[model samples]
Target: MSLRVLALLVLLSIQNLFAQQLSPEASIRVLTIGPGYNLNDAFGHSAFHIQDHSQNIDMVFNYGVYDFDTPNFYTKFAQGKLHYLIGVNYFDDFMLMYKRQNRTVQSQELDLDTGQKQALFDYLLENYKPENRRYLYDFFYNNCATKIRDVLQTAVGEPIVFHEPEAFQPQTFRTLIQDNLKTNSWGSMGIDLALGSVIDQTATAEEHMFLPEYIHTFFSSATLGNSNKKLVKQDKTLYTKQAINSNKSSFFTSPIFVLGVIGLFIVIITYFDFIKGKRSRWLDFTISVLTGVIGLLLLLLWFATDHTATAQNYNLLWAFPLNIILGIQLLKKQPKPWVIKFLKFLFIMLALMAFHWSVGIQVFAPVLIPLLLALVIRYMYLVYYLKNEKL
Candidate 1:
């Protein structure tokens, strides 16, 4: 027999033996980190903490780690093809990092027998291996927080009953996300614009684990299938977040204020052009171009990407992609008669957008209210001007 083959067999046996000998004193914990001020950190994070007193081993298994150096990183991220990997860190280092960020760190020890603990530990070690580490990340489903719930189910080899946390109210995926963001902030507006109506659907109780805070709450009340034993044995606050001075952005710099200013300018210009009975071709051209470009990007996000959350976007109603061609036609001394119909179509699209919002099909950014009203006025003015010019 080859020495290499014999050595490999012996190594595999040793690994199996070590896995089986997981100390009864070992404990598996779920760590929940509080949200930070940044948009990326708004949702918070979750990880597995494995500590074995007998073996003097303490490590953290994190599913949120991603490499910025991956090929076509930005492009893949936009396409929703980015991969996140499991990363192992020293327990102290993990706690210290979150502590420095002034984020609250909470830990929940699981109530599991030695067999279940060993199974979970072995599973994490297997997942930590290079070839098995990376997985496709999804914001609403297979993310860092969801991984905690998933790994527990897998290791325990049973369905987990995630009971509703106290005072738990069912909320749409979008609502759940917006709960973590300020209403008039640019971050919230961007999310409303980029994501689509799919997020408007209410999330199931078990599905709410996609957020770290929910993971902590749900796991606290979770139990193994057909068993009344609680999933979490105890909870501890490792580091309480310290209150800091408010660094909120100025109100003038907020999305509502900025967009409101721009919208008011458009309305004032359109009113003047209506009184003068003259079309402000430059202003119309600029608005059409900007809205058209944004619409095209939204369309691409819906159609050309793997993002499930970007489907059926309603923002395109106001920012019509066909406006780009209409803008170019307006630059002509004599645009075709069809331009009038196109203007009317844009007005109808605005009305439809309102209808969707009212009927709860989709919820648009509140910051866009002023801009939408301005678009309606401009479209109506353009239609009247084109009709009078033809007379």
Candidate 2:
């Protein structure tokens, strides 16, 4: 059903229940459905208990990630087979879904209600403190427990105390230390945050997520994922040496390989220059050779091993070394004052502008032309200076 239609049915049900000589002793509750918050489905796999006492009803909070909604419906919820459903959804839509069923609140802001609707809205304004939103300090508050509390109080025809979600603690400090060492690599930030600090290696976030993925593809067969399914392994692609050489590595890889190659080249180039004998152009050659070698190493490392994360650092490793050679060629006996001033202005301006995400270059490819020009200008200055001075 469309969200609008499903909402109307809930409101109609509430009115019918109230008109049919509603018993205050009769229970009423809302079960939210979505990622990590699945309290409504009888057959749903959830963590929260929803026991509908003969005297009252229990609401379940279900969270899910859109279309992947798990709709298990046979389990008795009295004991707590609900909860732990978290699905991705927009914030406003989430709030609107529940306001429709606060049977006790005569006001219906989502639809339309007159006197009681306005009163309930006023009450909501007083109670729903936007400042207390958790993601600001924490977000689980609005999305989980507090939401369920609103439903229960509405159903029972009385005020109910909203339980707080568990607090983040530092107990995992020791375990995090060990884990950091064990899994050391790039992109660990997302893994650490997603896992939380429970510290139990068995349920560690990285292991639960990355491991399942690693196991499914790395070990050859899908037996581990298909048969021993504790968590469903999403489509994580497996990488191989052949694929890395071919172009499959564009997705993500380590920077270590590129770094190693750069280090080796630097050593080789340095040794070669020492043996070849020095000229008046020695400084220019040294800087160009070392910087170029190092920069190329960085580019390769980023491309071959490192995951292409932010574009600030990229696979354009050749740019630096190439600029060095060009700069040496441009060195001069005396630089024009105007040339010096313009180069300085360009470099400083570019550096200052680097952080602006809205800058044209960041937003579009055409913006890069200016950066290329600036690089050329800098190269000319270096070359001009190398003969007698330096930029």
Candidate 3:
């Protein structure tokens, strides 16, 4: 066959195989984010106010800082409005809206990625003086923020009020982008692109205040989020040829996740040991067990997360320490024989899964898999031997 004929056949085959994946529309969804009544919303207070008029929104997601002394809102806005997001909903909505109409986030192409953000910030600190930071601020505001409002207005056919950066001063979009903006580094230009993404209507930004009451609100209101309620479709099939061969590691390459499983087993053991009169101080033992559970949750999050923005999720890296603590507690328990035997079986299974996953990582897999197996086996045997000897 001629090359053109061959190309046509390949295209048809691919189309027939997948039939164009489409997110089934549900009520023309528009996501809105708003501020918590409190200060903790990670974005800014001004954003929350804009989000309050949620008449057009299909889903409203609120974000707030964790209970740490530094709140998430106080974190610098990504040149104002953009955030590091990698979730299915964001992806689905973006793809859908673009297909529904020729909606674009940029007037000109803006490759908004992590490298772009770093390059832009670096340029500012290098070339611009502290007192002359107006150049930096002006470029971000007019080129990034105003262009954003203009783009959304074109799509929604309504004048949308975007959450301008705290540093924002109202100026003509043309003046900002064409005149002052050109003088700054090309990196600064990208910052405008990224910030433009964050506050755009399809992917709005808000301040989420995560209060203890927010959890309580969900529990108290039958209409709200239920932890027990399941999203069954979220479960993905494992061990496919692609899944097996892809460089991305699933449950196996996730060290924190694997440790979470180990911690859970330890907690179960500790509870049983207390029941068997082998240990006391239930609360302390319970804490030891819970550490594993929490670490495991962190592990799953790490795996599910967008690794391209590792810095955003860096807090979860500390989950490793908790996993270690859980291991120590398990070893201290001096397990009963049945418990040791069961753990030995689990260790073998976990090791096999790790090995399967490591196939993708090649040599790195070999080192990580064996080390994990040794840790599980070593701790289990130590507990078993101590228990039998009553030491």
Name the candidate that leads on lDDT: 1
Off by over 4 Å in 1: 1-20
lDDT of 3 at 266: 54
Leading candidate by TM-score? 1
Looking at candidate 3, what is the lDDT of residue 304?
A: 43
What is the number of backbone collisions in each predicted candidate, taken in the order shown?
A: 0, 53, 8
> For candidate 3, lDDT tens digit of each residue in 198-292?
22112112111111211111212212122332111121211111112324335453544554566565556655754574543343335335435
lDDT of 2 at 121: 26
Per-residue alpha-carbon lDDT of model 1 for 1-391, expressed as tens digits?
5746754654454344345457889999999999998999999999999888678677788897887878999999999999998877668878988998899999999999989988888898788666888899999999999999898899977778889988999999999999999999999999999999999999999888899999999988989778888989999999999998968799999999999999999999988887887888888889999999999999999999999999999999998898999999887767899999999999999999999999999999999999999998999888888898999
Better candidate number, 1 or 3, judged by lDDT:
1
Best-to-worst ranking by lDDT: 1, 2, 3
lDDT (Cα) of model 2: 0.31
Candidate 2, residues 162-200: lDDT per residue as tens digits?
Answer: 122235222232243333232222333222322221232
